[model samples]
Target: MKGFARRQRSVLGVADALRLGFLGLKARPGRSVLSALGISLGIAAAVAVLGISASSEADLLAQLGAAGNLLTVGAGQTMTGTPAPLPSTAAAMIRQIPPVQSVTATAYIDGASVRRTAEVPAIHTGGISVVAAEIGLPKTLDARLESGTFLTEATIHYPAVVLGAVAANVLGINAPGPGILVYVGHEYFTVVGILQPVTIAPEIDQSALIGFPMAESAFNPALQPTQVYLRSAADEVPAVSRVLPFTANPAHPETVRLKHPSDVLEARAKARTQFTGLFLGLGAVAVLVGSVGIANTMVIAVLERRREIGLRRALGARRSHVAAQFMIEAIVLSLIGGACGVLFGGVATLAYAAVTHQQTVVPAVAPLAGIAAALAAGSIAGIYPAYRAARLEPSEALRSGE
Candidate 1:
């Protein structure tokens, strides 16, 4: 009974086990760092992928929320397969709807090409479209001017144009000024403004917007609107969209097509989620490889430390103590790697978000989950090595060490 009490009292405590575990790692610093690096790489990849994906989704959601109330009406094809035109009064008629907040329209000027200079060939239109826009177009579309000013009531009747973001780039015109002019249709139109990209209306990003009066006088006297854009009260968007086609063209509702611009953003968000899953699978593969590396390193550690294991066993240490020491070492190693990974991932996320002009958003679960995964990998990887170290016969180990 006394001997049994003494043996029980000699069992290793948690602190003692941890101390010995760290001591073992300290003895082989090179191997310890290399083993931890494997885990670090895997965890860093996982955390960074999740962080970046979350940031992208957050930015998309923000854009959707801001523009969700916007709806567009465009003329569709007629039964004869020819282009159908919307009535010039469509914007005014749609504004009469109770839920409609603002309305604007644009007329697509066919056969009208815009060029940087009149000397450039007419065939090199750079895929740009010339559109006749209302003075209220920028406000209705929620677009911003990168430089200069938008079309005003006083300037709409003159040969003035606002270059869309893409149009400005294609024309190699960075800013709008008094003398900056682009050849439109048969004449030179002074550039009045340069617009930033409009997320809800990509077509606006590739158009050279001229006012309706100038378009009518210079391009076509009987020009009809090709598209109408409107904003509705937040809660009334669905109802407004349902009645928009009928309201825009009472003669033929089917000839007017209605679209909610936010739907495209929602689809893109779904696609990003699917791609995130693929990236997570790749991260998992990396983790599995790291686990293998840890297991290999631990098995080698046990083999190389046979003499120490035997000395401890031949003294007062029990098999369970030996196992606990090895297990703790693995957990601690992976814990270190996880901490470093989290730090690296956070920095990477911030840098990427800043460069891409996206909002930074890291899910709280990402770092916690990464640490937990590392611990789990460590626990599993330590099992076989710990067991093998504990199972060594003291006598045999001592003989082999000699």
Candidate 2:
């Protein structure tokens, strides 16, 4: 009894157990690689999905940061469902608000149509609206000109037009230069500028802009402001929005409609978050499948290595030692797969971000969480197999091998 106790105490050291674990994996290199591949693929999928979503969200936030404080005011429909027009003084009224930084307004021309040339049929109006715009519109909206120049004070009274990004494409006009003309309201108006796509103001991207003075002279002298755009200090946006409708229309504040462009963008970001959750669930399913594969592989390994188990038991190795060896092997295999998965996932994220022209943003916790998940999967998968190997009596295992 004393000698048996001494042998049990001498069992297997950590280093020796680790060595045996590695040796077992090396003995069946092909099986080991396949098992690890399963884990790697699952981890990679999870990491890549999270990384890509994060990058996309970061890009959206950056755009919002540029123009999130911009707000739009328009008149709501009257009791008869006819659209109410904003008062001509609405922009001036909004500018009086202490929090308002800048204000500009545009009035849509009812019967005006714009085309590449007068020869084009008026029936093919290309879904584009003609709008009379203020000279300060580009500054108020923080909009960028893609080509040529925006409407200037000097050009406001002339037959000059500025095309929105989509309007330019629809009109087949790439850039504004000398002799570049668009037929507007049955007359030739020189194309003076083309704007870049406005993320915060998509409606502006689809309209053709003409100076207010030009629109009054050529299209309608009685044009009233239809849409009023304003920017406020970032921290004062909410307060400004609350009082904007009242300020824009003091007589009928309820008929004044206010829209936060940033809210629309934020809603889109939230929708993306919901999609990210769905994708994460898919990733989890893949990981579950990989864990099952590892469990199945380990069970088969235990069955195939009965002779080795019996020999080790006969040499006075404790059952706990044998169990620990299998556990370690499973964990090591998963760790290797996890490292590779992180590398592959990170590379995929960077490539996608670069192609999409977005800033890359991977959460620091992603790789760490992946590795932890892999380790946990390994622990769970090794349990039943380790138990089965440890339970075999030395004599019974030897006989089974024979």
Candidate 3:
């Protein structure tokens, strides 16, 4: 009997194992809390990083959505390095594209100065620009009218002018009405409308827009488009961009420069991953520190509880039972920390999003992955101490503790 192996013991049930595990932690409340804090901090860092990244990416994507499928085309230089102006009919050519929903172009009128009145010194020109604008500009730029109506077909040949937000302020034209005029190109143009703001083209916000007909007939007949703005189906943006050069300038397609502003937003959204990797590295370090803390705490616990281990061993408890008890206690401790960390991280992400005016976003896998990592860390840390505790000889342990 002395030389034979002991029969294997049965494992504890789930509920009973958890009960014993909870009691073991309760016996050392102070040390248990300190151990769990390390785990909580690690999990919190990981979860917060994920949540904040998702939120910021969501904000950028939302802005892209607002931009729609807008594209800007400008004149490019020739092989000789001389700058070129976009064709006068560039907007009309772009409109021929089937997917093109709206198209507008603007040409700067040179040698023009806008003043509140003729009495104002020429040097006092308010830095306002005079541009030839299409009637469809409001739709193309998705601009809002703050005062009177935009240039219409009947008003295109007349001296009607529309003021951007900044231009209106400088010209002392708060509201558009009859008898209100601003001196431009040695002529007085009646202010017909004031625009709120233009997001796609912020330069438009500082300039005065006049109808193309008025610009050609009175201001400058040879004026050509300096910039073109257009919108097409989202799926057709690439196709439209490819052919825009040929369509705008058949003889010299190379003299056109096209840009998709939405592509810039998409690039920014993808760039979020760069920061995510850095944040995740920080989180990994935190988790590593937590794992070390757990391992240290468990080793100390095993040393301090040798007598308890011996008494249980003397009372017919198997070696496996001792190991199971300590291992379960470690898992429970880590779980408690993981849960608290999830709550803390979620609140922090939401609060930050609200302050920054970004949409709150949290990936579904974040919490599950966090908890699983905690469980894995806890299990690995429990192994050495659990085996050491189970290896003690009952009589020798009891004698050594005396």
Candidate 4:
């Protein structure tokens, strides 16, 4: 209500409000810092959560986007997600679909052991379609070499293997140099090549990858493919889904199953909405307490300045002027706290990302949004106190101590 009168004072514009706020902060540096701390904590928590959310989203998209029109298997309503079966004959027939760009079967190898003499347990091993080298894995793996190259179409039929960075060192496939022979599963297989290190997931520590056909035919017939990756055109996705038996059924018709990012994104958004509401509620509580604190301070300031107010009224100053000064001071306090909160909050986000090993990435607008929110909340919280200050009668205020 008194905002216009507050703005009427050229000497008490936003610039002056800022300057006087600094004066107030300087008056009680300890209290000012403590007040700012609450806001800082609130913003910091929001920033950290936002950073993690962004990382999760980016990681998902990165993993999925790499497919380049590819589709991975869906777990069709079982105890756990399982890879559906598609025989070589059936897969070859699925290529008949107009939208099908490429088809490949991938199987993850669990409890796999490659022994030259002894066995090292708990290594991640899997075989993907031969096309995985062309599309799925990174190009750095392409540059890495040992005695041979990454497997090809011919190698799928032959007994060839590529060793991961860990595998090459542990088995002594290439000792201080080039090619050496190693035995995997009692079969005399040469270590055709050594691979650059690749992560099964960035979160995990160790794993290995190989061709699925090797696991199925040569390694263990009991071994089953955990997934199949397929690529299709953008417009063809709907068409592909119609044929692929993504749903649970005994006599499935299609060879491949497709999943889209939009479905996952919607689910994540719902989860995020829950957290966002929680943080907003906590922030509201903090700001409310801070508002109460400000109101108490303003009341004390007015009581002490009662005589000064009367003297100003006698000198022809308006009641609104008195109210404006008190209100501006309160808002000024909040604005200062808000700005400090932004700085500390930013530091918190950076520290968390560094400690967690996730990427240290933040949205550019978060800090700005935080600061704006702070100012808006402060202005709103100051209204009632400002109104009470404006309504004071000069005569009564002058006689207060008497």
Alpha-carbon TM-score of each model against the true structure: 0.96, 0.89, 0.74, 0.64
Q: How many clashes show up in model 4? A: 4
RMSD in order of candidates? 1.9, 2.8, 5.8, 7.9
Per-residue lDDT of 1-402 in model 4, one digit per residue for the tens? 865665443233556555654564466667656665655566555655565556555654554454335555432333355545544344445556678776544454544456554343324222211111222333311234434576676665555666666666655556322335544554545445666544322211122345555656766665544444456786777777766653312255443445653465456556876886687678667766766666666566666667766766656666666566666777777777677766766676677667755666667676776777667666765677667656777787688745
Kindly report which residue stretches of model 2 are placed more than 4 angstroms away from their true locations once superposed: 1-10, 117-121, 171-174, 179-181
Task: Give lDDT tens digits, candidate 1, residues 144-259.
Answer: 99999999998899999999999999999998898999999889989999999999899999999999999999989999999999999999998998898888998988888888
Off by over 4 Å in 4: 1-25, 43-68, 73-85, 108-207, 212-217, 221-226, 245-262, 304-314, 346-369, 387-402
| Candidate 2 residue lDDT tens string, 1-402 | 665654345468888988988898899899888888878887888788889999999988887897678999987887788787888899999999998999999999998888888899987789889999999999988899999999998999999989999999999999999799998988998899999998888888889999998898887888899999999999999999899888888877888888988888889999999998898788777777877888888899999999889998998878998889888888888777778888888988999999998888888888998899889888888898899999988999999999
TM-score winner between candidates 1 and 3? 1
TM-score of 3: 0.74
Quality of model 1 by C-alpha lDDT: 0.90
Model 4: lDDT to the true structure: 0.55
Each model's lDDT comes to 0.90, 0.88, 0.85, 0.55
CA RMSD (A), model 4: 7.9
By summed lDDT, which 10 consecutive residues of candidate 2 come out lowest? 2-11
Residue 352 lDDT (model 1)? 91
User: Which prediction has the highest TM-score against the true structure?
Assistant: 1
TM-score of 1: 0.96
Model 1 deviation from native, Cα RMSD in Å? 1.9
| Ten contiguous residues with the weakest lDDT in model 3 | 59-68
Clashing pairs in 1: none
Model 3, C-alpha of 143: deviation from truth (Å): 5.7
Ranking of predictions according to TM-score: 1, 2, 3, 4
Instruction: Using lDDT as the measure, name the better of candidate 1 and candidate 4.
Output: 1
Tens-digit lDDT track of model 3 for 1-402: 899999776566778878988998899899888888888888888888899999998776766775768989888899999988887788888899999988889888887778888888877767889888989888887889999999999888998889999999877788999888988777888999999967557688889889888899996778899889999999998898899999988889998998877777777767788888888888778777877787788888888888888988998888988898889888888888888777777888888899987888889888998899889888987888889988999998787677
